[model samples]
Target: MKKILNDPKRFVDEMLEGLYAAHPGMLGYTGGDLRCLVRADAPVQGKVALATGGGSGHLPVFLGYVGRGMLDGCAIGDVFQSPSADQMLAVTRQIHGGKGVLYIYGNYGGDIMNFDMATEMASMEDIEVRTVLVKDDVASAPAERAETRRGVAGMVFAFKTAGAKADQGGSLDEVEAVAQRTLANTRTMGVALGPCILPTVGKPGFTLGEDEMELGMGIHGEPGVRRGKLETADQIAEQILATITADMPLNSGDRVAVMVNGLGATPLEELYILYRRVHQLLADQGVSIHRPFIGEFATSMEMPGASITLFKLDDELIPLLDHPAHTPFFRV
Candidate 1:
């Protein structure tokens, strides 16, 4: 309930206002609506455009990646809510640089519905659109039903690979292919220690005991696979890595990219501690760490938790992951 703001209803508006104000010429909006955010230098003619949208509160997520080598546009909604189809369509139109547009987002019902509606609407305007839903949360569903799982921090990998492909002059189909490929090779497992309060609601969506944690919890406080007493950092990392490696077995000679992401309230030091374990564990398996991303890549509005994402990599994806990308919150 404790947050710094003037009006509860104006939270998103004011946040976007400040974002635009702080990053002028680097970011902007469409149709005079701040909800439909796009790169300032949008419609880079003939380049396939990448767009994503989801609720707010997860900053640098649906909004932060809109930049030089990432998403071209995004349709933002309220905290943990989906944006309207109209808003999505506005972003699609504004960033459709003549080649086509690709929509990459998590596998959530509201988002799927609205993005599909936007796709249909864009078709009437002759804008070709392709959709790729990120289904990387291994804990959400069994391997056989992974297609039904929710997307998590792993979607960031998809964003990077897909965006790099598009910026490199790949066609719509090519970019979408890279996105799907990246997501298919990614797996994520999260543990939550506390819940985040919504700005308007002014209360935590869920709660955890002072000495407990929930393993494999969703970013939105959805039920996790296990709940029990809190464990040490190394223990948490091992547990998460066990599940991830089981799902996507890492071979002795395989190379991989790892990300230890904070769920908002966790500090940078803690993230690095988690990453250290991840790196050591992977090394023990003879897997080389091609790259490591440790930070608050995605969040739940001050939620206390962290997620580990393992992205099985090959020669093709390494370059894409290493590609220079610049956004307000992320750079590589």
Candidate 2:
């Protein structure tokens, strides 16, 4: 339960302040009340604006993706909490280019409700808006209705694809189509090694024994599918990869992108350890790794865990993915 902060109540604001200070060229606050971080020179004339929002604990999820080739703006809420409708509308107003805006975020209830309200508000202003929800966590729901599954790290790919499409002067409808396609092709599952401490609570959100690991855990410390004795890195990778592959069924000659993401506290060395096994497993499946990104692309505070996200890419997606993207948190 150790943290460095002046006051727990001000943790969100203070953290945003520090982030802006560190990357002033890339981030800034909007209208003061709305915790909106937009590209310093946003509303890029004729391009459709891409905006996403969610809780704050997951670094690089909602905020870190705001950059030149990603989201145009992002509304950040408190840790693991959804932003208010007004906040979303403010970001929409700020980033609305002549073209319409697209709201791409997770399928969590709070986000859905708030973004729906925001969409209605934006309509009143004659600003067209479209929404896409990422539902890629196969472990959260049955395959018969996989769309009900929760969104995880796969949202990153959606952001990149949608942004690249918009950057290339695609219509708002076209950009939304690219994002939806990316989500449909993505699937993810995660394992938790330890719980994360909320900044306000100053205690672990949940408990896990030193020798036990939880499979299929949510990023917000939600219960996972199973708990068992820790196993070798290869065994763990196999378990996760099998679940993802079974749900998606990558065949021989299939090309895909792999994201081996750390929850939070898992170091780079350990993530690479897991990635080694993941690489071997994918090779054994005869699947070609198109573009591999391994790091803390998404995280839950200081939680110790990792997730695997697979995007079965097609011809169009491969180039959009490879398109140059430069952000503080992601670069290509």
Candidate 3:
């Protein structure tokens, strides 16, 4: 790999050091372990705390969202690796306010195992803990088995919705409910043109042809549902929209929040081009978009591609989604 850095083994640590320095008082880590990061002003007494953990390389994801009106803490792992249960428990202990703590993260096997262990450990200490798993990648599983699908960019909506609820002083149950609701209404489809290189591996995790693309690829380089010659931006948007709508059919007067997310290396200009077509297609269906989030909300390490996420909104969710939020990597 031609990436810049010294000692691939220290990649995650060095990155955390820079992240802490950049954010300063806004973000801090538990104990001396940089993997267990939390808001600098954590344990907002009596407020429900939100925590999430997952493999690294997907920034603004499990870590970047920690701040006011978002996650209270995050257990960070190495690139494409799950954080240990001990790290997760450390974050839970550091962020648990008097009210309770809620664990919200993607539906990944490693994360599920580690987070579940942390939850049980916290429960023994008399700390109430709740969990909400995000599963919105429609291509990962059939509609009948959505719960088995993987989580992707749709996590942004879940974090925003649930974080707003917690910031509004909602109970733990209420916050978890809103997170579940947001994810239930969200669906994501991704197309990747290239793969990313892990620091330690020093090679691309997957390969794609010069004139090829994979539809519905996972962030960690998992095989997509289909691979074929590359298509136009409009065609890509249409295919993704068709798949999402088939899973969560939209009707006239339905409101939604659209996110055209860049994987890592895709430019904002290209994302907006895709968004332009998405807008037209949604308008054609009589669906009104309440908000259009266009940018790199989630990413793989230097992966060239994009994902589209559609969050079907309701009267209650619209306001929560619009609620003011401020974090290092996200704001509203």
Candidate 4:
């Protein structure tokens, strides 16, 4: 496998070190645990603290959103592995303003368990904790069971929405409420044309035929709902939009926030080609887009694919999404 690193065992550690080096003024760490990254100006005295985390390899995900108006702190784990509860606890302690802390993360089994353990640990120290699990990937479960679906790129909206509320000095409950609301209004579907090689694993865990694609695949190469021959960009876009709309069913007067996200290796030009179709599809349905985002908001190492996320907006959600944020990776 062709990878860039000194030691696979040190991949997570070294990556964090590099992140700090690249943005020293904007990023900092909880003293002993390098994995717990925080905004340089953390524990803002009066504002609610927001913390989110997950495995590494998805840059701008658990860590990339750390800054003034995004995550106050984040607990990072090894690639595709949940961060330890202790790591979560350390970040909690680092960013706990008297206003309390809220933990926002994707809805994965390991992430949920570890974050829960950290919440319990924080309660022992009298730190109030709240959580909002993002479960927006439509392909992971039936429409009747969205709560069971895995969170994907839709969380970019979650982080921005909830972080804006917190940055506005909203209480922990208020922040948590907005986080859940944002998640509830979001849906995501992805298609992967190739696979990614994990450094430690030394190879791709799953593979696709040269002329094949997997629809609704997870960021870590989790099985999607379908596997079939590669289709044209228009066909792929139609399949994704059909599946998402069948579940969510945007109406004629509905408004949405569209995100065309690259899984990792998908080029920006290709992403726009896909987004053009997404825009047209929504327009044809008479749905208005608020602000369309296009880029690699979330990734899976070097995997070649993309995911589309639509955030249904209401009168209340529009402002929260447009709130200004200053993060190392995300700015709004």
Candidate 5:
């Protein structure tokens, strides 16, 4: 119950206000709706606009990725809640370019339902909309049904690929193809050590013992496959990497982009500790690491955990990934 805030009901509003204040030149809201944050230079004419929406708490996510070379607009809901279809539709109409719009978001039930409705609403106005759901969490479901699996940190890769394609004047179909290809080639797995407290709930979303950790946990405190005593950083990394690599089956000569993301509260030092083992393990397997990103790319408030995402890269994908991208939270 220990949190610093003036009012729980206004948490999301206050946070958005602070965000716009800090980056006025880069971001702004549409029609004064806190749920809709668009780039300062959005609605690029005659180009395909990329829009994504999801719940709050997972910062640097649904909102932070909105800017040049990334998302043109984002619709944000409350913590762990999906945005209303109307809200998503509003952002869609405001940012739709003459070409069309592409919706890239994680694989979640609420998001799927609302985005689908929004697509239909946009169709009435002759604005074409497509979607690419990121389903990379190996822990969410069996390999046979990975498409139904929950999306996790691997979403960041999808955003980069789609955004790069859009930035290069690619058509909506081209952007959709690249996003799907990236999603198909990516795999991720995560472990949780502690839970995050929701601002409104005024308590931890879940609880764990001091010496216990949960394997295969989802970002929103979803149940993991196993719970047991905590292990060393190397051990944890091995477990997660094994699941991801097994699902994807990377060869010795393969190249990949490695992302070791902290859920929220995990420190950079700990993430680097895990990354050290991750790099060594991949090297031992003869897999080459091309570009590595290690930090809080996606998170669940202040949860204590990390996830590993591997995107097997080809020539086209590698270059698109290397393309310059500038956002409020990610610059490369």
Candidate 6:
């Protein structure tokens, strides 16, 4: 792959080193392990500690979300690979406050396995750990089995909602509940127009023709549900919103949070064009938009695509989403 790097074997390490160097005030390494990134000032006593981790290469995700009002810490892994169970345990300990800890991440097989192992390890040390798996991509599974869907851009909304709850001194159970609620209300669908090359493999993980697009592709280049000739942004937007709204029907007078997330390489101008259709569609349906996040909230490593995440907001959710949050990549 054509990338700016020296050693393929040292990709994760070197990438994290650059992340820390670029944002030391917001991120701190633990035990000299670059993978265990905690907020520079962690261990906020009497408040629920929020921690998330999984495969890397998705910037503003596993690492960029670490900071005030976001994640207390995160155990990072190599590109598109789950962190070791021991890594999760270490980062959990670093951020554990007296109130306990909540482990939140996307619903992936490896992530579930590693986080479960970490929970068992932490329990032995008297660290109360709760877990929430974000599964918001509606196109990944039938509505009857939503839990089987892959988590995508919608996970970022979960992080924001739950992190705000923790920052407000919510209990472990309370924080976990809010995160679960966020996931329940959130749904995402994506369209990939191009492929990305992994630094280690030295080639594109997957491929797509110039006139083609894959719908509902996962962040790690996993095959999406369908491939078809590319269409206009409005057509793609309408198709995705139809699936989302069908699965989670929006009622008249209902309010929602909107996230138009770029998969990596899609430019802001294009994303905004997509968002314009989303906003218009929602208005046409009589749904109110609250806190519309229109940017690269979650991303793949320079893949060209975009996803729309609609979070059905309620009274409890609106405040949590509105709470002031300051991270290196996200602020409000």
The clash number for model 4 is 0
What TM-score should be assigned to candidate 1? Answer: 0.99
TM-score of each: 0.99, 0.98, 0.99, 0.98, 0.98, 0.98
- Candidate 5, residues 1-332: lDDT per residue as tens digits? 77778899888888998998899999887866878888887788877899999999998887888888878999999989999998899899888879999999999999999999999999998999999998888999988887789988888888898899999999999999999999999988889999999899898877899999999999899998799999999999999888887888988989999999999989999999999999999999999999999999989888999999999999999988888899889987
A best-first ranking of the candidates according to their lDDT comes to 3, 1, 4, 5, 2, 6
* Stretches of candidate 4 exceeding 4 Å from the true structure: none
Error of 2 at 129 (Å): 0.7
lDDT of 6: 0.89
Tell how far residue 213 is off in model 6, in angstroms: 0.6
lDDT per residue (tens digit) for residues 1-332 in model 6:
66888898898998888888888788887877899889999887778999999888888887778878889999998888999898899999999988888888988999999999999999999999999888998878888887788888888888888999999988888899999999999999998998877788888877898899999888888788889999999999999999999999998899999999999999999999999999999999999898789888788888999999999999999999988889888897
Q: Is candidate 3 or candidate 6 better by TM-score?
A: 3
CA lDDT scores, all candidates in order: 0.93, 0.90, 0.94, 0.91, 0.90, 0.89
The Cα error of candidate 1 at residue 98, in Å, is: 0.9
Off by over 4 Å in 3: none
Superposed model 6: Cα runs more than 4 Å off: none
Q: Tens digits of per-residue lDDT for model 4 on 13-132?
A: 999888889999999999678898988888889889999999999887879888877789999999999999999999999999889998888989999999999999999999999989
Candidate 1 C-alpha lDDT tens digits along 112-195: 999999999999999999999988998999989988999889999999999999999998888989998898899999999999
Q: Which candidate number maximizes lDDT?
A: 3
Candidate number with the higher lDDT (2 or 3): 3
CA error at residue 90 for candidate 5, angstroms: 1.1
What is the clash tally of candidate 5?
0
Error of 5 at 19 (Å): 0.6
* Cand. 4 TM to true fold: 0.98
Better of 4 and 5 by lDDT: 4
